[model samples]
Target chain A: DVKVTQSSRYLVKRTGEKVFLECVQDMDHENMFWYRQDPGLGLRLIYFSYDVKMKEKGDIPEGYSVSREKKERFSLILESASTNQTSMYLCASSFRESPLHFGNGTRLTVT
Target chain B: AQSVAQPEDQVNVAEGNPLTVKCTYSVSGNPYLFWYVQYPNRGLQFLLKYITGDNLVKGSYGFEAEFNKSQTSFHLKKPSALVSDSALYFCAVTPLFKAAGNKLTFGGGTRVLVKP
Candidate 1:
């Protein structure tokens, strides 16, 4: 079983502050993704990395960035946290041809 | 680009009753379909996927999905509903959606509420 772990279950940040959400996968899967879930907007992809040092912008990548310095870890960075950015963030990893294995998720609140 | 849609925002069902959640998708080529369930505050869980062999695929938790190419739909179904089955359901598509061979596209999602 693949275990995708997010560093925090809940986080609160002050507006305009920078926030970092970390994720690590036990399985050395090459693909890692960050997504935000909102009430009516389902899941919107933020960023994804297919390999260390490689990253791709997803549908909604503005105000966000990502890092993949190590194969097992992927990090999402919010340059400046805003109340509009508060939402449940999910981390997932997957191998080619397989389904994504997800972490429980981190609920970030920007106050 | 590939896209998925869950027509209904919510589906209500009674325990022991058949449960169905509708899903439809559009893709550039052959579609690889998927169903996922998300419990409150949890990440989405893979339910079942339709590749090719059979139009119907069975997955964890006694859940199954049937693929209808003509209708461009893949609907999730269960013979019996349990209170625990209540959750948010999402449908996805890939080539782009597959294992993320590319980008994965998802539907808006449908919330299932099983009443006693």
Candidate 2:
């Protein structure tokens, strides 16, 4: 079984603070994705990286950025956290035409 | 652009009974549809996907989904509902023409409850 590890399960941050959420996968999958899960909106893609040092903006990437310094690791950075940014963030990895394997997720709370 | 829709917000069913969750979608070209389930406090788990070939796709945990191209629907089904089957379900889709890194568009999600 593939294991995708998230650095934090729960996080609390104050407004205007910078937040970094880290994810690492063991399968060496080339495609990594970051999504924010909300009550009614389901999961919305925030950012994704297809290779190290390569990233693409998703539908809702206004306040977020991503870094893929290593093939196994992808990090999501919130430049300035706000109350509206409080949500569960998910990390997923997949190979070409394969189903995505996801990490448990990190719940962020910005107050 | 591609879009997925799960019409029902919640579906209540009894154990041992048939379970079905409805989904519809729209996309520019061919659709790559998928179904996922999320246990509480957990990330979404891939249930099944319809890429090509047979319309009926069987997936993990005894879950199956049928792809209907004419209706633009991909509905998930289970022969018998188990209490453990209770979870939040989401239907997702991506355009076939896109590259490998294509991101999926998800529905609002449907919560399933199986009673004893």
Candidate 3:
């Protein structure tokens, strides 16, 4: 079984604060992704890493950055958090061409 | 670019009745389609996937999906609905070609409600 773990289940941050959302995967998968889920938007990709230190922007990557210094870990960084960035953040990892295994998700509330 | 669409925003069904959640997709090459269910406050859980082989694929929790190349659709189905089945369902797609990368383009999602 594959396990993806997100560091926080719920988070609250003030505006302009630098927030870090961390994720780690037990399986040695090559792909990891960060997504934000809103009521009508479903899950929009924020960022993804194909390999350690290799990152790619997804559809909505403007307000975020990502780090993949290690294969097992992927971190999403909000350089300066805002209320609009609040959503249910999910971390997922998968082997090449496989279905993604996801963490429980972190509900972020930016105030 | 690959894309997926779940036409209905929500689907309501009575318990013990059959349920279907529709999904359609577009991609330049062969598509790798998937269905996932997200429970309240939880991340999405994989339900089924269609890579190749038989068009009808069965997955966890008695859910199944049919892949139709001509229609470019992969609609999810279940024999009977349960209250526990109420959740948000998302359809996602990725191109079969490696050049497209492993990124999945997801649909807006369909909220399933199973009423007793």
Itemize residue pairs with steric clashes in candidate 3.
Answer: none
lDDT per residue (tens digit) for residues B34-73 in model 1: 8989999889999988878888899999999999989999
Each candidate's DockQ = 0.65, 0.70, 0.64
The reply for model 1, stretches above 4 Å from the true place, is B96-102
lDDT string, candidate 2, B78-99, tens digits: 9999999999999999988763
Give the CAPRI class of candidate 1.
medium
TM-score of each: 0.96, 0.98, 0.96
Q: What lDDT tens digits, residue by residue, belong to model 2 across residues A10-85?
A: 9999999999999999998999999999998989999998899999999999999999999999999999999999
Fnat values, one per model, are: 0.57, 0.60, 0.60
Candidate with the greatest DockQ versus the true structure: 2
- Scored on chain A only, each candidate's TM-score is 0.98, 0.99, 0.99
Q: Of models 2 and 3, which has the larger TM-score?
A: 2
Arranged by TM-score with the best first, the candidates are 2, 3, 1
Which number leads on TM-score?
Answer: 2
